[model samples]
Target chain A: MLNIENLHVSVGDKPILKGINLQVKPGEIHAIMGPNGSGKSTLSHVLSGKSGYTVTQGQVTYEGKDLTEMAPEIRAREGVFLAFQYPVEIPGVSNIYLLKAALNSIRKHQGLSEVDAMDFLTLIKEKVRLLEMDEKFLYRAVNEGFSGGEKKRNEILQMAVLEPKLCILDETDSGLDIDALKVVAEGVNSIRSPERSFVMITHYQRLLDYIKPDFVHVLAHGQIVKSGGPELALELEEKGYSWVENKQAA
Target chain B: MTTQTASRYTAEYSKIETTLPGGSLPWLRALRSDALKQFSGCGFPSLREEEWRYTNVSGIEKNLFEPRLEPSDNQIDKDWLENYRLADCWQIVLVDGYYSAEFSVLAGLPENVTIKSLKESLEAGDGQIEPYLGKAVGIDEHSFVAFNTAWFTDGAYIRIPAKTVLDKPVQLLHVVTDPNRLAATRNLVIAESMAQAQVIETYVGVDQAYLSAAVTEVFVEPNADLTMIKLQCESEKAYHFGGTYVKQARDARFNHHNFAFGSLLARSDIHSDLSHGSECHLNGLYLGVKRQHLDNHTRINHLEPYGISRELYKGVLDGRARGVFQGRVVVAEDAQKTDSEMNNRNLLLSNDAEADTKPQLEIYADDVKCAHGVTVGQLDEKSVFYLQSRCVDEETARNMLTFAFANEMVTKITQKSLHDLVLAEVLKRFPQQGIMQDWL
Candidate 1:
């Protein structure tokens, strides 16, 4: 479902993701763990088409299409979703309004009829209930004044709404408590299907206990030094990325 | 040759002054003469002037404008007027600076509510109009205010009797339909002791090239309450200059919401005098797009003890547009418990767009609460990504988020029809393909 070939990215002139290559098939969950400043977030940003990042060399393909040239919105319409580490607080837009616009945009791209207000409300209400999110959240501005757990849950709620083909959860578990972590993971797990793929980026293996990954890739200094099964996450959580760095240097 | 040009310029003003309307009341005649003198001395405020630094009023000098001599038979289209007409209220219509008796509807006015034109009020032995007509604003300081004071033909006159509560809102509609002509109108509103009222004023223009200058004076008597909402949506090529001067009596409450969305060159001046124990709230939002320029200047005076004031002005500029906000709040001596806060926020969507916000506070009282804040920047990248990541395109995401920023002020409008009208105009000026359509 997703492929990255020799992707070298930089912020300004400083290379962040250097010679990175990875691949994931449908229904597969991949976990990328790295130390701080080890290009973990940079990989996610570059994959999601964020500006201010220079792709010096390499290409990214999603579902057999070149993803490097697509704008962020086009990538989004093409079923690429990024759950931000810090959800943005949009002061004046309600969450329901944002969600409806997102759903309609994707629906239009897919040659489907846009959802009406009533149908949209019904759709979101079901998802909100499924996520155990408060219905009042739909009325308030998107993520404005929301607690940390609420923001992460809101991110997951958006993932559920958009139902993207490829989901990238970037540091989604950083600020969450144990309860929120489980709920968020549960939300992610419920959406796992054979036709969908997910890339979960985390520092600890706590979130892996809920949504286990099929592949674990250890990223250090902008390259994947090791790749293994879900147990690699627990091993790294125990030994840390320093051992991976030493192994890569060797 | 140089002396010849200087004499020619002086001769032009002399020629123009003679053509102005004359033979009014002595006091009014004297006031107009003095104002004309001041106007001649100042000419047009150049960009070199500190207050006019960002605003270029050379357009006014480019075209020679004559005060509207007579009301035109060219009536406003009923459909267009109907779109702006507020129902279930006492309505007053002023067309081309003259009260339109044919279009006005006044029914079921409470016994204490007084609504009339300035002419009728003056002729009907009402001496109250003369005392507060031009007391709040200095005509000598502002060229447009001076011009409005000099040439105003007639305007709406409203007076709420002491201790009276006006259950219904009073709607004032000012319409201009002539492109080549200029109209200056003046309004005076007074709410006596313990009286309460809501005033909604709508300024409409039909011709794109016409000019409209207006001044409104409001005096809130002791313990009275007043909420005034001004909606300025003129033609795209029209020029609009307006001034609103408010004076709150002891323990009175005065609130103003100024919404400006359309015009080629528009500037609004809002000044409030918060006297002893008075409370004032001023909120404004200016939406400018394309080549439009919208400027708002607000001044609040906290005079006497225990006066409070709060102000928030937001601007959204796109497509090489320019927005200016100059706010000043003054706390006078003996105003010990005075509390004042002012904030201005601007969103520039394009690289060519610009915004200038200057918040000024002067406090003479040692014990006071005064705070001012200003923020100018582009839309948040994280927020934009958050929306786009949801499958909303970049343009639509931007529009929605920008609209939300300005909607905070639009939703504060209490009247539904007026609110919808202003909201529609505001949305029309938003950047295309941004979040405007869905929320609007």
Candidate 2:
């Protein structure tokens, strides 16, 4: 469903992502483990078409179309989603309003009619229940004064509502407690289908314990130095990222 | 040139002076003569004055707006008038600055509550208005007050008895129907000790060039509570000047909400004086589009100890519009433990749009606490990008953000019909795509 070949990304004069290659078929989950400054966020940001980052020399294609050419909103309508690590607090726009607007935008892009108000409410309520959030959260301003765990779960709820084809979770487990992590993982696992894919970018292996990935890639010094099965995550957890970084250096 | 403009108005004053209200009362006649002299000396406020530096009233001079000697017998579209009239309230209608007994809705009003025309009250010779007419704000405060005092034909007179709680709000609806007509109105609202009331002042007019200058004096007696709302949605070609002066007695509470949405050029001044252990809250929102210029000036005075005051004014300027906000807070020497905070925030939506904000805090008491802040800039880019990624197009995202910025102030209105009316007016001034009313 997605392919990145020779991905070289830089922010201003600094080269953040050196050279990376990745391929993902439908219904696959890939966990990218990295230490500080390993360019995990850079990859997710580039994939989501965030500005301020120049793709020095690489190509990313989603569903056989050049992903970099699409505008952020166009990419979102085309079914590429990026869950931000730190969600922005929009003081005036309510959370439910945003969900309706997004869902309608996607439906319009696909030449479908706007969602019925009652049906939209039903769908949204079901998703909110799946995420174990209060109905009041849907009416309140988006993420304004929301707890960290609540924000993460809100992102997951949005993902479930929009049902994007390719989901990029950026540090979704960073601020979540054990309970929130389980809830988020369960939400993600429930949406797993043969037509969808995911790229989980995380700093630790703790999140992998709940939402196990099909493959694990160790990213260090702007490159993926190791790729293996789920057991590699357990090994990395036991010995720490230095095991991979030192091995790459030697 | 200023003297020349003043002379032009002075030349026309003699034709209408004899027809003005309260002409039979000696004291009111002397007061009107003094006000006329004050207005003749200064004319309209000029840019030379510190307070009027950002605004120029030369347009009023050039237009030569004339006052209506009596309430016009012109037919008014009831459907159009109904838009500005609030439901479930006692309404006093003033057309071209003269009270319209035919259009007013005051049936079933409480017996003790006095809601009548200023001219009617003056003709009764009750002498009830003598103490509060110019007590809160004298003509010397500015030339607009002087001008309104000299030119006003009629206005609403509202007074709630002591310890009385009004069951329904009173709305003063001012409408201008003729081009080049001047609507000058003077209003007095008094809530006696331990009373509770809410009042609304609405300004709207036909699509034409005219002038509407109004001055309202409000008194909250000891331990009384008053909430006043001023919604100005005049014609796009009209000029508007409205000032609300307030005096709060010991332990009295006063709240004001100012919404400025229409007119080619408009200015509103809201000033309040707080006594011992009193509280004052002032909230305002101004939205300007096209070449419209909206200016809001506010001042809060702490006259006695343990007084509290809060003020917040937000503005949204689009197109070539220019918005101005000037706020000041003063704490007196004997007003120990005075607490005051003032904030003004402005959002400019175009390269040509401008926002000028100035916040001043003057403190004389060592134990007082006062703080003020101001901001003038564009929308937050992080917020824009966040919305964009959420599937909203760039244009809709910007519009949504702008609408949301102004909606913050609209949400504070407690009256359901009034809130919906103000919300509709606000939405009309901006792009409404993707901003559904049901969402709010």
Candidate 3:
């Protein structure tokens, strides 16, 4: 469903991602594990079409179309979701208001009718229940004064509502506790289908215990140095990232 | 600095002096004459003065707006007037600075409450008028106060009895019709000890280039609670000057909400003084579009110990408009434990739009908590991208953010009808899709 070939990304004068290649077919979950300053965030930002990052050389394709050329909103409407590492706090715009606007925009892009108000409410309430959140959260301002775990669950709830084709989780598990991590993982697992795909970017292997990935890739020094099965995550967690660095250096 | 422009208004004073209210009272006449002398000497406030530096009143000097001698219903538009005359309240309508009895609605008003025209109150020898007049604010405070005292023809006089709780708000609606008409009015609102009441001052006029200057003095007696709201939606081509000065007794509570949405050039001053253990809250929102200029000035004085004050003012300026906010908070030496915070935020939507904000805190008490903040900026780019990622286009996202920025102040109004009315006015200025009133 998505392909990244020789993607070289730079932020201003500094090069962050150098000649990266990754591929994800439909219904696949890929986990990218990295230490500090390993360009994990750079890759997710480039994929989501965030500004301030220049793709010096490379191409990213989604459903056989150029993804990098699309604007952020256009990419969003085209079903490419990026769960931010730190969700923004919008003080005045309510949570339900934004969800409705986003859903309507996506529907309009696909030439579908706007969701009925009653139906929209039902769908949102169901999603809120799935995420085990209070109904009052939908009426409050978007992420304003929300706890870390609540913000992560809010992102997952949004993913459940929008039902995007390709989801990119950028450090979604960093601030979540064990209980919140289970809830978020359950929410993500419930939405898993043959037509959906996910790319999870994390710094620790603890999140992998909740949501197992089909394949694991160890990213270091701006490139993937090792690719293995789920057992590789346990080995890395036991031996530390230095083992991977030593092996790759050898 | 005095200017020669006051000669024009002074020259025409003889024609309307006999027609003004309370001409038969010697005390009133002496007050008017003293104010006229002050106005004649100082003229209108000039830009050289520290307080009037941001605003220039040369426009008033250039035009000679004459006041109507009597209340006239010849050009009154009932349909348009209904837009501002709120329901379920006692209303007092003033047209061209004269009370219009035909358009006022005061049925079922409490017997203890005194609600009538200031002119009628003066004619009936109601001794209550003299003590409150020029009490909260003196004519020497500025030239505008002197001008209003000298030229005001009529206004509403409201007094809620001691220990009385008003069932409904009192609406003082000010309207003007003629193109070059001057509407200068003086109002007095008094809440006796232990009383609670709400008052709303609404300003509207026909589509013309006139002048509307009004001064309202308020007194909240000991332990009384008074909430006042000023909604100024004057004609776009008109000029407006409104000042509300208040005095709070010991343990009194006062709240003022100022919403300025219309007028080509407008200036409003809201000043309050707090006594021992009293509390005061001041909130204001000004939206300027086209070439409109709106200026809001506020001051809070903590005179005794344990007084508290909070002030917040927000402005949205678009096109070539300019919005100004000047806020000052003063704590006296005797006012120990004074808690005060002042904030002014402005949003400039266009390259030509401008916002000038100044916040001053003068504290004499060494042990006091006083803080102030000011910000003049465009929309937050991170917020814009956040909305854009939620599938909102860049333009819509900007509009939504701007509307939300101003709506924060609108939601502070608790009265349903008034909140809806003010919300409609805000929506009319910045119309955005998906901004349903139900959602708010």
Candidate 4:
């Protein structure tokens, strides 16, 4: 479903991701673990086509199409979803309104009709229930004054609604408590299907307990230093990122 | 001492001095003369004056518009007028600065409520007019106020008795029909103690270069409540200057909703003086397109202790349009425990479009709580990207965010019909595509 070859990205003059390579197949879940400032979030941002990033050398291929040339919204229409590490809060735009606009936009991209108000509400009600989110929350502004857990949950809710072909979770478990982590993981698990792919970026191995990944790759200083099955996560958890750094240097 | 426009209006006033309403009354005669003297001395305020710094009135001054004294058979389309006339209310229509009983509908009005033409009331010598007319707005404030006072031939006069609450709102519709026509109308609204009323002042005109100058003085007595809405949708070639001055007694409440969407150049002044324990809320929205220039100036004065005031003004400028918002709140030395907040936000859509907002809070009382904020910028790129990430197109995303910003003020209107009307006007100023008005 996705392929990256020696992806070198930078913000201004500072290199963030240097010679990074990754591959993901359909129905597969890949967990990318790294220490702070190890280009974890930068990978997610570059994948989502956010501005202010200079990809000097590399190509990202998604479904045999050049992903780098697409605008952020075109990537969205092509079923690429990024659960932002830090979601932006828009004061006057309601969650429901945004949901409908987004859904309709993607539908239009695929030559589908716009959803009626009543039908859209009915469609969102099920997802709102799945996330255990209050229906009233749909009427409020987009993540304005929302609690940290609620923001993360809202990102997952968006994922569930959009039903993207590829879902990229960027630090989705960073600030969540134990209960919130479980709920977020539950949301991710419910949406897991053979046709969809998942990329989980995390600082800790705690989220692996729920929604376990098929493979884990340890990222150090922008490159993947170690790759293994789920057992590699346990070893890294026992021996902190310093061990990984020392191993890479040696 | 007077410039061309100022002395021109003064000269026009001299031509019809004997025919102007209240001419027989000595007090009104002296009042008009005094106002004319003040206007002649000051002329049209130049940019040198602090209040008129941003707005230059040379356009209105260059053309000497003659005040229309009679209701001409200008063939006003009834259907066109019906668009502005709200349903189920007593409407007082002023056409070309003349009271038109034909266009006005006063059916089924209550006896306690006094709704009539200002000229008629003055001719009938209605004793209620003397105490409230010119009571709130002084003639020496500016040239526009002085011009409206000295030259206004007719307007609306509504008096609600104590404890009387009208079932429906009152609509004061000012219609301009001729080219080079000036409609100088003055309104006097008096709500006695415990009275409640909602009044709407609407100004619409032909697609011609005309001038509409109006002044309204509202007196909300102790414990009374009054809500006033001003909708200015004049022609693109027209010029407009309107001022609404309010004086609130102890425990009184006043709310103002101002929408400025028209006129080649438009300026609206809303000022209120709050007494002990009184509360005031001023909300305004201005949308400018093309070469339109819209200016909104507001002032709130807290005279006694325990007065509260809240103000919010938002502007959207596109297509080389310029919008200006200047708001000031003053807390007197004796006005302890005064709570006031004022905010002005502007969105400039195009590169050439400009917005200037200045918010001022002057508190002489030590115990008062006052805050003011002003912002002028383009839409947030982060917000735009967020919407786009949700699959919304960049243009649609921008339009949605822009509409949402201006819609805040429209949602403040609780009146359903008025809300829809104002919403339509606001939507008209935008491109009107890709934004789901239904969803909002």
lDDT of 2 by residue, B1-440 (tens): 28689789889999999899898999999999999999889878889988888998889878889999887998888899888889988999999999998988999998999999998899888689999999999999999999999988999999999999999889999999999999999999999999999999999999999999999999999999999999999999999999999999999999999999999999999999999999999999999999999999998999999999988899999899999999989899999999899999999999999998989888999998888899998999878888888999888888888888899999999998899889989988877633656456
Model 2, position B309: C-alpha lDDT score: 93
Higher-ranked by DockQ: 1 or 3: 3
Q: Model 3 RMSD to the real structure?
A: 1.8
lDDT of 2 by residue, A1-250 (tens): 8999999999999999899999989999999999989999999989987889999998999999999899899999999888999999999899999999899999999999999999999999999999999999999899999999999999999999999999999999998899999999999999999989999999989999999899999899899999998999999999999999999989
Model 1 complex DockQ against the native: 0.67
* Lowest-sum lDDT 10-residue window in model 2 chain B: B431-440
lDDT of 3 by residue, B1-440 (tens): 35588888889999999988898888999999999999999999988988888888888877899998887767788898998988888899999998888988998899999778998899888888998898899889999999999999999999999999999999999999889899999999999999999999999999998999999999999999999999999999999999999999999999999999999999999999999999999999999999999999999999999999999999999999999999999999999999999999999999999999999999999999999999999998888887888888888888888888998999998988788889888988975634545346
Please give, for residues A29-120, the per-residue lDDT of candidate 4 as tens digits.
99999999999998988888888999999889999998999998999999999998888898888998888878888999999999887888
DockQ of 3: 0.69
lDDT of 1 by residue, A54-81 (tens): 9999989998899988988889999999
TM-score of each: 0.93, 0.96, 0.97, 0.97
Displacement of the residue B165 alpha carbon in candidate 4, Å: 1.7
Residue A166's lDDT in candidate 1: 93
Q: Rank the candidates by DockQ, best first.
A: 4, 2, 3, 1
Better of 2 and 4 by TM-score: 4
| Candidate 1 vs candidate 4, TM-score winner | 4
Docking quality tier of candidate 1? Answer: medium
B9-90, model 4: which lDDT tens digit per residue?
7777767777789988888988988888888888988898898888988998678888865667899977877888877767
- Model number with the top DockQ: 4
For candidate 4, the per-residue lDDT at B184 reads: 90
Which prediction has more favorable DockQ, 2 or 3?
2
